[model samples]
Target: MDIFTLTIIVSIVIYIFIGNYAGRSVKQIDDYFVAGRQAPTLLIVGTLVASVMSSTVFLAESAFTYDGQMGPFVLFPQMGTVGYIYGALFFGRYLRRSRTTTVAAFFGERFNSHRVQQAAGLSIIVALGGYLLVVTQGAAILLSDLTALTYTQSLLIAWLSYTAFTLYSGSKGVLLTDTLMFLLFMVATLLFTFYLVSDLGGISAAIQGLSQLEHKADIASWHGVIGAGTEFPTAMDYLIWAIIIDISWGIVFAVSPWQSSRHLMAKNEHVVLRASIYACIAAGVLQVLIYGIGGFINLANPDITPSESAIIWAAKNMVPEFLGALLLAGIMAAALSSASTFLSLVGFSASNDIVRPSSPKKTLNLRATRWIMLAIGLLVLGASLFLPPSIFWLTYFVGTVFASSWGPVAFMCIWSKTITASGAFWGMISGFFLNVIPTALQYLELIDLPSYMDPILIGAACSLVVTVLVSRCGHVSRQEKVYRMRLHRTPAGERDLKQTKISVIAPAILALYGCVMAYLMVTFYVTPYQTASGQLLPNGQVDWATGEAFLSVSWALLYIPLALLTYILIWRSYSPGAKNIEQAQTKA
Candidate 1:
């Protein structure tokens, strides 16, 4: 076998070993489901970043940027990171307080309804099952290309590798293995990106080169290669699509089963908040590096076909052999990390939420959960063999299902006194079906929906309307009211003044990093457009008639610093000092 193929095989073997080793700690369902709720900040952050970044970012998202859509594509992560703060403040803490094994259980317990839990669990199975299929195909695709194996053979290998460890080790194995994968991919991506940028004569010259490319004019502009020939015909069309999708993704970050569930594994409410703050920073930095270099790769080799293959192509042809092998392995790491997380949740929900409510026996529940996980893995493997991969769009479609279906209901469950079990159950059901059915019909060409009428918008609006209406027709019981109040009350372990002060430093650092990014964009991106004055584009190669788009895009980055500063203020209110005052007022 080639060095690249050998490297990938070795990595998977190591992960399997590590996962089984960690499995030795599993003594109960909690250990299997949430790492006994004792995970520290690093493991939580690792899994959070690993689970979300997947091959979708490495391949699908990179393809968008490679095709000169970097301007708008970057906004998705920008908004998504903002959702992390939302989770820290409004959603994740209460989830840990509920002390549920899965996000589905949180819903069930919060409402005191088994049916609601089953409904939430079913949504996770269907949605995350689809997501699992997408990421599995991603890993197989990577392996097939890097090695001599056919797609089917690679699919089987990838499936068994993640499944074996996931079944035996459960969350303990997955968490430890995910952290290892996270560190591997992160270091590999940074190294490859640094080399590529230097090769293109640094960021300044690369931007200038991108502006003058004959076939890809406006590549560096805010709208990014827009025209009649592109997927987005007009600037307005592109901006609207970007904004809508970005907002959906923001909701995904806040409440998606995979992302929010990581908080359930954290050691305490403080770990949830601190890990989320750091995870947001890590994801933002990595995406900017990954997506930022996507368009720049075109400067190195413009003929890369099937833009999804852009990253793989660069690894083989643009970098040294060792670095290339490591990068390819990193991409596989992304796919495996996500696939394992999705598959585990599928098993967890199927057994814990769907089956456990009926079984009621501990041994039967454990046996059913493992078997269900195995069955789901096999099912996904079969699907991978036949399903045509559309990695980026498929990932987006399935992920947004959670945003529409769960986002509104998740937040309301915590903050709204009027919401009832009926509202949540129906809201999840409607939101999921409304989003899925319309998008399916549109794709089948049975109906033509306008570009502005994205199904995500329709489904989310439907969900919100139905939830409010259904909630109005019902009443919150005393039990539900007390539960809500308890969630709001501060946990004794979380009321630490010293830890709060320490946690503040992370956001403070991120706020400063945001300042640095804003400065760099101004110096590298906006300044060039301003001085373009026709010299940078000597042959009228420049696409824009003015610099408005450039200036607006550059200045918009300031929102990051502004948002982080605001978050720091909110985080401080969690200090014991603030909690004591609130408690005194309540007593009064």
Candidate 2:
């Protein structure tokens, strides 16, 4: 066998070994679900980063960037940085403090309703199922190109490798193995990116080449880039839509099951807070490096078609034999890390949230979780093999489902006391259907809508409005009102005004930072000036001079400060006093 294929085989073996080793720790449901709630900050950070940066980002987003549908550096890194920071301060810490094992369980406790928990769990399954299909299909396509296997055969290999560890080892195995995979992928990505840049002569040469290309204007235009010239439709084509999608999707993604569960696994709220900083930094640096490589590769070899194959093609054609093997292994690592996490999540939701809640048997629950993991793996594998769709569309569909259906309810549960159980439940259900039904119709060519009217935006608006309206119309009982008031209380005690101020001020500062960055992006990157004839120009379609200015200013002024500020805010929020407060709460 070739060195690349052999390396991939060895990596798969190592992952299975690690999963087996980790499985020894799983004697109980707690260990399986949340790693016994004893994971340190670094493991939590690693797992969170690995789980959140899935094949979608490495394969699909890189493909989109290679095709010039969006600037990965401009969009993804900023979104993640802002999202995780806000999540750590507002959602992560508080959610961990609530001591819930799952996001669905948190909804149950927050609203005192089991039905709401079931609804939340079902929504998670649907959304995560869609995400898993995308990851699997993306991996299968890449593997098919690399090996002589058919897509179905490639998918079976990928699915079995992903499921073997998850079914045996549970959360402990998943997290530990995910950390190892994170390291492997990080190294491979750095090496591949370095080689790509060097092979293109340099960053300056790459950019210049890209600028001189025939599609230079199209590539640089943020609001008008197409996919493979025609095969994929333009989804993000306006400045306002891009801004909203990035920030909104970022926040929802941070609180999603695979990401937020890391907070629960942490040793303490302080770990959750600190690990958020670590995850943000790692994600920001890696995204910029890898996506920069994608852009440079496109510039070097503009003839690489199908766009999604750009990264794989660069690894094979541009790197040395051994390094190329490692790069391919890294891609495998990315795919498995994410797939394993989602598999485990679906299992946990199935057993703990959906099944065990009604049946209430510990041993049966444990066995059932394992079985469910296998079932989910097979189910998603079947979907990928039989009903495969384009990577971008699948991701967009699932992302919208999660963002619109679960996003509003999750935010309100953590931050607001007035959202009634009825409102949360109905709002989620309504938002889900409203988003899915129209998109399904659109997919079937039975209806058409304005290009700019994204389903996610509409669904989120409708969900938010319904939630507020229903909440206002309903009344909480005296006892439940008091319970909610307690739920909102700071662990440091409400008497501690200093802690309260810190809580409020941290998010406020981050919000200010996000707003400033948005303003800068709009002013420097998205705005369009009129021509000499007084005709208006299209946004994000700038002249060469304007493009140079935008790139230079954004590189120096925007991302650097945003990164630094994120670190500072996280450091400040995880004070010794915060730990003391948490300890005191534990004692109480």
The numbered model that scores best in lDDT is 1
User: Cα lDDT of all candidates, in order?
Assistant: 0.82, 0.71
The TM-score values for the models, in the order shown, are: 0.94, 0.84
Q: Once superposed on the true structure, which residue ranges of model 2 sit more than 4 Å away at CA? A: 70-77, 221-236, 356-364, 478-483, 486-588
Error of 1 at 167 (Å): 1.1
Q: TM-score of model 2 relative to the true fold?
A: 0.84
Alpha carbon deviation, residue 98, candidate 2 (Å): 1.6
Candidate 1's C-alpha runs over 4 A off are: 74-77, 356-365, 529-573, 580-588
Judge candidate 1 at residue 474 and give its lDDT.
94
Best by TM-score: 1
- Our tally of clashes for model 2 stands at 0
